[model samples]
Target: MVRAQVLHGRVLDAETQQPIPNAQVGVADNRLGTSTNDDGRFVLSIPPAYQAARLTVALLGYRSHTQALPPLPGPELRIELKISPAALGEVQVTGLVEGIVREAVARIPRNNPARATQLTGFYRESDNDTIGRPRYLVEGLLTVFKPDYRQPGDDGDVQIRQVRKVDLRPAGQAVRIDWAGGPFIAQFGDFVHRRAQFINPRHFRDYAYRLGPGSSYAGRAVYVVAFGPRKGNSRADCEGQLYIDQASYAFLGAEWHYTAGGLRRARHSGASSRQLRVAYQPYAGRWHLKTVWWQTQARLPIGPPLNYFGEFLTTAIDTAQVARPGYVERAQTHDVFLRTTVAYDSAFWAGQTTLLPPAALRQALLDQPRQQRADSLFRRRRTGADSSTVGPAARPTPRESGRLGFLGRLSFGAAVGLFPLAGAGGELAVRYTPAGSGFALRGTAAVATPGPALATSFDYQFVLTKTLALRLVTTWLHGQFEGEGWQLGANYQRNLRPGHRPLYGRAGLAYIRQTVAYPVGTFDNPDDALRVAGTKLGADRLSARLQTLTEAVLPTLGLGLELTHQFELVADAGYLLHLRTRAQLQLDEESGFFLTRSSATINLPNADVDLRVNNQPTATLPWQPQHWLLSVGLHYRLRP
Candidate 1:
C-alpha cells in the first residue's frame, strides 16, 4: 500500500474575505473529493497516483478556482473565489421566463441519467440546543443506490457502512428527537428529481416565474429562474432560484427555503425556518447529484431553539455492474445511526477524503482513546471480584444495562404539577449518579401561581434486601416564591417495589422560613368590621407582607411506569406542613394602598382616632395555609 499525502486548506470569498462553507474541493474528473465545513476548513488525503493532479474548488454562484498541488508538509493553502453574480440583462431582454422554466422541467428525464447508479459518500450532521449549544455530532460513511431519475416515488436505499457519533448535551438533559434517517434528508429534499411543486409542469399554474440573472454551475452557464407561489394561490410552498443548463436545459442546481406562511401552516412543525441546496455535475454524459446541503431552525416548546444541519458529498459513483446493498446491511428509515457504535479507527479516518469536524469535535475525537482506556479500567475493577465464579447472566455488565456513555448514569424529567395553594404548574427535574454508587444529586424547578420554585438535594441509598431499599435525602434552598423564605430539611425514602418500575413512599420533617402575603380582598368584610370598631383606615384595599418560621412534616408517594428502555411515566403526591398566614396593613402613598403598618389613624367627626399595635386588631381566618401537591411527568434515562 502506498502512503497518501495529506492536504489542508481554507476557502474564502475574495471580496469579503469571509470563509465560504460547503464549497466543493476535490480533484476534477475523478472519485476524490470533499466539501468545506461550516468554518470553511477542509482536509484531503491524496493517493500517490493523484500527486500530479491539480486541485479544483467550486461553489454555486462563485467563480471556480484551480491551483497546482503543493509538496507534502507545506503551509495551509488559502484559496479565495470571486462571486459570479447572475446578470439579468439577457434574461429580461428575452422575456421568456416561464417558457425557460417549463422547458427545463420537460427536459429532466432527457438530461438526467435513466439508468441506476451507485453513490458512496461521506455524511455528517450537527445539532445545537435552543441556546445554540452543541447538542450532538454524527458522521458516517454510507452508500446510496439511486434508481432511475424518471422512476416515480423511489427516493433510494441507503446503507450505513462505518459510523461514529458523540453526544455533547450536558448530562441529565433529554433530547426527544433521535434524528433517525438524518443522512437521507439531502436525498429526500431533491427538488429537481422529485419534481417539486414549483418545478412540476402540472403545478406550473400555481407558481409565477420571473427571469433572473444567469450564473455558472460546474463550468456551465445556467439560466437562473426565480419562482414563488402564484398570486392568490394559497399554497404552502417555498421561493428560490433554479439553475438550469442553458445549452441542454438540464437542471444543474437549485436553492430554496420555506416561507413564513408555509411554516405557520405546518401544524406542530416547530420549524421557524428551513433551507436546502443541491447541485449536480455532468459525468459520463449524464448529470449526477454531486453535493447536497440542508439546514433548519426549530423552536422547542421548552428551553432554547434547536438548529439542525446535514451535508452529503459524493466521493465516488459507479454505474457499470453496480450492486445493491444486501438486506442485512440495508438501514431502515427509522434507524438512528448514533445509537450504533463502531470502534474509532484512526487509520480508517486518515485514509478517507472527508470533511474536517469543528475544533471542539476534533478535540473530542482525539479524547476517545483516553475515554476508552478509562472504561476498560472501570470494567476490570468492577468485574474482578467474580471473574472466575460469576456467570454473565448473574452479573450484568454496564454495557448490557446501557450505562457506558458519558450520560449513562443520568435521568431527566418534565411534568405538570398541581398544588392546592400554587395551582397548576410545570416542573423540570434532573438526577445524576455515578455507576456502582448509592449517592446521587438532584435538581428541580417548578413554575406555578405564586412563583417559580427551585430546589437541589443530595441522596444516599442503602439496600436492605433484594426487594427493598432506604434512601436519605437532604434538600436546601427549596421554596415556592422568589425573594421569599426557603426550606432546609431531611427526608427518608422507602422503595415499595424492587426489580421493577419505581414505586416508593417518602416521609420526613423539615424547617421552613417563609413570608406570606395577601391582598386586602382576602378579607370579606374588612371595611364593615373596621367601621364597627369606629376605626376607618382610609384605603380601598389593604395588603401586607408577613414573615414567619415553622417546622413541618412531609409525606409523599410516588410511582413510575416504563414507557421505553430509556423513558418512563412518573407521578407523585405530597403535602407540606401548616402555618398561620399573617399580614400587616399600612398605607402606601404611591398606590394609595395600606400595607405592613405598625399603627394607623381613623378619621372621626372632629379629630383622628389613633390606633396602636394591639392583639385586638388581628383578624382570624377559617382556612389552613398548608399545601398539597400532585405531579405527573415523563422521565428519561440518558444512557440509551
Candidate 2:
C-alpha cells in the first residue's frame, strides 16, 4: 500500500476573489469529505489507498470545482468557485419540454445515487484508418469506484483489472490518440459532471425543444426530448436528446451532438465528423450510467497531397448496477490510467471478458507508444527510478530536457481531445532542436481564418558560443491571399534557476521583411489569420523593420492541482520591439508598446488565449486595422 498525506486548501469566490466559508470538500470519491470553517480553509486526510484520487469541492449557489490530487509533497492548494448562473427553474415554462428539464434538475439529488459503490466496466476504444479500416484498438476491464453524485462521479478511483489493445497499421502511418487522456474522455459520458453548460434554466430559451417518440429502458417508459439551438441561431446551436423517466422525471440517459452550425468550428478543431451515444441502467430504483459510445473522424492536412484521415471509436459498459448496502473501501491510492505498468498478459486476458483484436493488429499494437507507456510504469518501479520531470514517471532518457528538450522532443501529451471544440478556429505547431548542439530549428503549421500554412526557422551558434546564435526565419502562408517572410537575427540565451520547470530567457535582434502580414493592432504571427477557408491580405503591402525580442518561459506554473507530467498549465512572458523603417506600423506607431498578460488559466491544455496590448500583440492583429486581438486557438498534436 502507498503512504497517504494530508491535503489542505482554501476556497475562494471567482468573482469577488475572496474567501468563501462553509464550502464542502472531499476526495473525488467519498472516502472522506469535509466542510471549510468560516475562513474558507479546511484540511482532509487521505488514506494510503487513494493518493491518486481526485479532490473536489462543492457549495450551493456556486459551480462545483474538481481536480486530480497532485503527487506527494505537492504545492499549496487553492480552489476558486464561479457563481453558478443556473436558472434554477426560473425559465418561462410555456412548454412541457422545458418543464420536464426543470423538473429533472429539481429531482436530481433524489433520483441520482449519491452512495458508495463499485463498477466492473467493460471498456473499448479504437481508431480507424482513412478508409474506415480499424487502425488502433484497446479493450479493458476497469474496476472503478463509483463516488457520490453530490460531488463528481470521477472523484471515484478506478483500477484496470485486465487490458489489451490492437493496432493494424505501421508505426509511421498509424493514427494515435493521447492515452493519458483516455482516463477522462470516458468521464464525459457522466453528463451531470461534464455537460454543466446546457443545464442552466437561464439558457433554456436558447434551445427549441420537441417531444420524440417514447422509448422503454429496462421495461420502464422514458420521455424523449429533442432539443437544438433555436432557428436563426446557427452559431450557438447544440442538438441532442434527453432520456427522462416519466414517473420520477429522473434523467435516465442523455444523447447530444452539435448541429450543422456547430460543425464549422468542430471540423477545424480536429474531427471532421463525430457523434456520442450514452445509456443508463436502473437498479434499486436509482439510475446508474450504463453504456457510452463516442465515434469521431478527422482529416488533418499535414502538407500538400498529404491529407490524413483517422477515426476514433469508443464504447463502455457498466456491470455493477448498484452498490450493496454500506459498501466501503479505502480512498484510491493510485489512479488506474497512470499506474498499471505491466505488459500484455495473454493468459490473464484469455480468461477475462475482453475485446481481442486480430493477430496482426495485436502485433502492431506492440509497436505503439501506448504499449511503451504501459510497460514503462513497473519497469521504473522495479528499479526504484521515478522521475518528476516533463514525461511520465517511467520516462526514458530518449526524451530531451531544458529548452532544447522542449524544442527538440516530440511528445503527444496529456490533453483531453474531446474538449476545447467550442469557438477555436484551427492550429498546428512543432519545434525541433537537435541534441548536443547550439543549433535549433522551429516550425509552425496552421489553418487560420484562412486555408493552410507552413512556417520554419533555423539558428546556429553565432556569437558568445551557443548562448548567442544567428538565426534565419521563413514562412509560407496559403489562404485567399498568400504571404511570405524572410528574417535574419542574433539571440542571447540563459536558463533560469532550475527546478521542476526548465525556465529560460532570451533576447534577440533582427532585420525583418514581410508582406501581407497582420499589422500592429493584432498579433505578429501571420499564421493567426489562417482559417478553414483561408486568410485574406491586400496587395502592395510591404514591411521592412528592425526587430528586438526578449522573452521568458515559466513552464511550471499551473492552477489546478492535477499531477500531470505534460505542460498542463504554464506561463510565458515576452516583449517584442518592432521599429518600422518602411511604412508605419499601426499600434507600434500609434501610441504605446504592445503589452500582454494571461492567467488563472487552466482552461484547456492545448488551447491558447492571447491578449495583445498596443505595446503587445494579441493572437491576431489588424496590421493597420482598428483594434487588437483576443485569439483562441484549438490545437491537435498528431505527433510528438
Candidate 3:
C-alpha cells in the first residue's frame, strides 16, 4: 500500500489577482516540490513524515510564502504572493546593472556549490506536431549528478530511475523530433554554471545591459537586469531579464527568449524560436537549482512548425553524501530519454508530485482524434465471454492494438526477391479489422520483375492468440505471364525489445503455390518470314507474347523484423522447396496450327510484331525459378 498527503491549491498575485503560472511550491527545509500549471493550479503529494513541515510557495519577482497545512485531505487553498515595493522602485534606477552582472559572474563559485551534488527530480517533456497537436509526452524520475560549479567544460551525468512514454499522436503519424538528451537541457541550461551565452563574462561586451526596477525572488531582494545584443554585435541574438540577489550576488532566476536576429540565424538550423527559464533557491550556504522550464519551435521546411515544452523540477536535493553514477548508469549525451527501457512503476508515480497539464491538454491525451473514432467503427467488438477465444477475455480489438490509428494501417512496402520473380518491387496495401475481434482483411497491389509482372493479393488474418496469427492469402500475377497463387500460413509476433521505439519479429510457415512461366521459341514477323521463306507467317516477332502456366506445391518458411513505430524498417527472408516444372502453350490462329510442321530460324530484334500463339515451352527450353527470397523496406502497419 502507498500513502501520501494530497495538497491542492491556486497561486495568484495579491495586487492584480492574476494567476501565477510556473510558481514553485514545495515543503520548507526539504526538496519535495511541484510547479503550477498554466492556470496556476497545483497538486502536491507529501509523505506522512512531512506533515509538520510548512508549505513554501515562491516565484521569481515575488515574495516567498510559508504556511502550515490546514488539515488532511483539506479543501483547495489559495496562495497570494505580492511584489515588494522597494524592489519596484529599485528597477527604475537602471544604473550599475553591468557591475552587478559582472559581480554575479565572478561570484558563481562562491554562491553555488563547488562540490558535486546529486539531484533527484521529476522531468516531463511534451511535444506537438506540425499542426500543433500533441505528438507525445515523456515523464521520468531522474537522478542527476553535477560537477563542481568551478569546472569549466564538464557537463554532468544523469541516471534515469523510472520512465513512462505516452504516445499522444493521432495514431500512425511519425514524430520527427530527435528529442535526444532531453534531460540535459536542464543541466546544460544553467548559464550561471556553464558561464556561456548571456552569462559568460567574456561575451558580456557583446551585450548591452540595463537595470530594471528592483524585484524580490525567494524572499530575497534582487536586481532585475535586462540584456540585449549591443549595436553592431553579432555574437548572439539573445535578450532577457535576469534576477540577481542584491546581497549575495547570486542569480535567483532568469527568463530569456530569442531575438529576431537570433530567430533568423536559428532558421538556418530549422529552429524558429527558443525560450528558457531557470530558477534557483539558496540552501545550506549554497544555491541549488530549483527548476528549469523551456519551450521551443522547430520550423520544418515542409510542414507546420513543431512546438516543444519541457520542465525539470528539483523534487529532492542531496548536497551531502553525494556520489556520481557509475559510467554504465550515466545517460549518454545522444540517448533519447523517452526511449529508455526502464519499466513503469505505478506506485512510485503515484507517490510523486507531478505537475498536471492544462485541462485541454489532458483531454487531448486521453481522447482519440475524430478520424480515429470513425475508424474504430469498422472494428468488431467482443460480446459475451467465449471459451474458444485464444487471447485474454479483455483485449483491444485488432484495429486498436497498435499505437497508430486508421491511416496508419495503410502502408506501402518494397522488397527484393530471388525466386519466381527475380527483381525488386513495391506494394501498396490497406488493412481492415473489427473491434475486439482478432480477424483482419488486407489487399495489396504490387509490381515486380525479371518479367516485371503486375500482381494483386487479398489476405485474411485471424489472430489465434496474443502474439500469434494465422493467415490465408490468394494472389494473381499478370503482365508477362498470367498466373495465380495461394498460401496458408501462421506467424508469431511480439515485441523483442521494449522502449519508446519498439522492435518486433515475425516468423511463419505456409503451404504455398509457386507458379513459374518458362520461355518458348521466338516467332518471326509475317512480312519478313514471307519475304525470306516465301511463306506467310502466323505471328510477328515483336508482337509475339508467350506464356506458360505451371505450378508446384511447396512449403515456405519466412521471417521478418521491424523496428521503430511510425515509419518502420522491415527486413524479410523466405525459403521455398524447389520443384521441376513442365510448360505448354496455346494458339489462336489456323496459321499457327499449320506452322507446327515447319522449321525456321529468325532474327527479330527491334522488329514490329504481333503474337498469334502463346504456348508452353518446348522440351529444348530449360530455365527454372530460384527458391529463395530476401528484401528490406520501409512502411507502416497495424501492429498485431
Candidate 4:
C-alpha cells in the first residue's frame, strides 16, 4: 500500500499582495496535480514514496516555483508561492542562447492543450549594441480577442487585427497572420528547425561548455553565450548570442544573425548575402515572440538574360516563334526591419476544453476586418492626408520608375514527324518617363523563331501627349530560303470618350522592304538547296501601305470586330509576288491552335521566265491598288 500526505498552498501576486486563483500545483515527476479555486488555495496529495521529491507550483503568466517536501504524517500542510513579474515575463530565444533559456523553461510544463491561444502583453525591443536608439521603443498592449480554431468540418478561416503608430504598422502586419493561427507553437516549430538546426538538443550538446561565462547589462546580471557551426560542419545561415537572467536562469533577451548564402542568387542578380540583429523584452513566460528587429543586406550577382519563347502573329501558317538572344546582369541592395508582441490572460489558460460558442467566434472573426478598416479611416481622419489626390498638395513620387511587360503565344494543331507543328514567341519592353507627360520614351524588341524559320522585330513608341502617339516599327525575317524586311509607320490617336470605356481612332502609313529566295531545281539536300537558291534565286519587294482603321463592335467577352482597309502599291521587281495572307488562331481558354490563317494568293509576274536573272529584263510584278485585311480574334482585357 502507498502512504501519502496532503499539502495545501495559496498563490499570491508579490507586487499586488493579492491571491492568484486557479494556480497549478503538481509533483515534479508525477502527473498528480490540481489548480487553486476562486480563493487561490490548492490542496496537493503526495505519496510517501515522493517524500524526498520536489513539488512545482505554476500559474499562467507567472513564474513557476519548486520546493522539496519533508517526510510527514497524515496532516494538511500549508505553503505560499509568490509571483515575480520579471521572472514570469520573458521571451524564448533559441539557437545560441537556447541552453540558458531551457534551464528556466523546462521547469514549466504546458498544461493548456488548446492549439489556439490569445496573448495580450506590453513590449519593448531594441538592438544589442546599444549604439543608436532602439528601432521599436514604443510600449503597447494587444489582444487577439479571437483565436482561429481548426476543428473537424471547420472552414479555413484566419482573422487578425491590431492598432499601432503608422511607423510601426509594418511590423504589426507581419505577425497578425501568425497570431491568428493560435499560439506561437506552430509558428515557432515552423521557423526553428528541430532536427540538425537550432532547436535540436543533439546538435547543441556542446553549447553549455562553449558558453564560457556570464555578464551583466544595465545592472542586471545576465549570462552571455555565443554559438557557431560545429567543427567539420559548413557555415549555416544563422548565428547569435543569448542574454539570460543569472539568478533565475530566465531568458531576458537575445541577438541573432542569419544569411541565406546560396538563396541570394534566387532573389536577384548579385552576390549572395546575410543579416544580423537583436530582440528584447518582447513577451512573457509563454515563450511568445514579442518584438524582433533585424537589419539585413545582401549582394547578388547579375543573372543571364531572360529567354522568352512563343509566337508573334496569332494567325499564319509556317510562322516561326522568335527568341531574344541577349544577356543582362545587375547588382542590388536592400534593408529590412521586423517586430512583434503578445499578450496573455490567466483566466483563459485555466479552463476546461470546450468549443468557443459559434456566436462568439463569429463576432470575433468579423470584428477583425472592421477593426482594420476603422484603424485606416482613423489614421486618414487624424492625418488629413489623401494620397490618391494629385496636384501641388499631393505627395511627391519617387524617382527612377520603370515597368517590364511581355506577351507571347504558343500553339500547335497537329503532329509532323512525331513533333507538334508548334510556334512560340514573346516581346520584351522597357519604358522610361522623367515626368508623367514630359519626354516619355519606350523601346520594344521581339522575336519568334519556330522550326525552319525565324522573325524578329524592334519598335520605339513616343507619346507626346494624352492625345498624340508616334511609333516606328521595323522587322527582319529569315526562313528556309532566307528573307528580311523593315517597316516604318506613325499613328495619331484621338480619344472620343473619356470615362470607363474610352473610344479612339488611329491612322498610319507604312513603307516595307522584303526579300525572298526561291529554289531553281529539285534540291533534295537542304544545305545544297540553300546554296543553289542563293546563287540563282530572284528576290525583291518594295511596298507602301496606306491604312484606315474603324472599330465597329466591342463586347465584354474581349471580342472586338474592327474593319481595316489598306491600299498596297507593290514594286516586286521581276520575281513573283507570292501574296500569302494567313492567320493563326488560339483560344484563350485552352492550349493548341484553334485556327490557321485564311490565305489567298495573288500571283505576280504574269509571264513566267527562265530565271537567269541577267537574261530577264528588270520587271515590276503585278501591282495591287487596294487590299482589305479583316482581323477577327478575341482580345481579353486582363483583370486588375
lDDT tens digits by residue: candidate 2, 27-129: 6343345555446776565666767778767654467677898765566588998865332232243667778788887777688776756655556565554
Task: Compose the digit string of candidate 4's lDDT tens values, residues 1-640.
Answer: 7656656566667667676654545563323455554456655555566567777665433566677774555344455555333331244445545555456444222311124333332222222112322222212222222122222122211112221211112223322110011221112212221122333455454333245355543234556656655554444435566555565554444555443433343233232333323222211222222222333232213322111110000000110221211111100011011222222122332222111112332343344334555666677778997734332222112111111111111111110111011233233232222222222223333324323324444444445454443444443434432333444444354534433233344444444444332212211111211111123111111111111111111111111121111111111111112234221110011112435212111122213211112233322211111222212122221101
What order do candidates take by lDDT, descending?
3, 1, 2, 4
Better of 2 and 3 by lDDT: 3
- What are the runs in model 4 whose C-alpha is more than 4 Å off? 1-114, 119-196, 201-209, 214-225, 243-253, 259-285, 298-640
Q: By descending TM-score, how would the candidates be arranged?
A: 3, 1, 2, 4
* Candidates 2 and 4 compared by lDDT, better number: 2
* Stretches > 4 Å off in candidate 3: 1-3, 15-17, 88-96, 130-132, 174-181, 260-268, 302-304, 340-348, 369-374, 378-640
Model 1 per-residue lDDT tens digits across residues 1-640: 7688889999999999999988878774545677787778988888888888888888878888888889965789899999886553343335458888888877878988788888878887778665444556678888888888897488777878788665644333453455434578646767776887778877788778886767775566777888888888767377898888777888878888887777777533788898888877766778878788888888777754668878887877778787767544666554566575543344556677777776656665455434544555567678774344323222111122243444444455566554333333334232223233332324334334443234343333343333343434433323453123444444444556555444545444445444332212112222322331233433333322221232355456676665555565767666776654442222222224337322231221111211112212223221123566555667655543
RMSD of each: 17.9, 22.8, 15.2, 22.4
Better of 1 and 3 by lDDT: 3
lDDT of 3 by residue, 251-366 (tens): 88888988877877763356678898988876678888878888887777664466887888888778879888764466655556555443232354776777767777766655
For all predicted structures, in order, the TM-scores are: 0.55, 0.41, 0.57, 0.28
Report how far off residue 376 is in candidate 2 (Å). Answer: 29
Model 1 global lDDT (CA atoms, 0 to 1): 0.61
Worst 10 residues of 2 by lDDT: 413-422
Indicate which candidate wins on lDDT: 3
- Model 1: which ten-residue window has the lowest total lDDT? 603-612
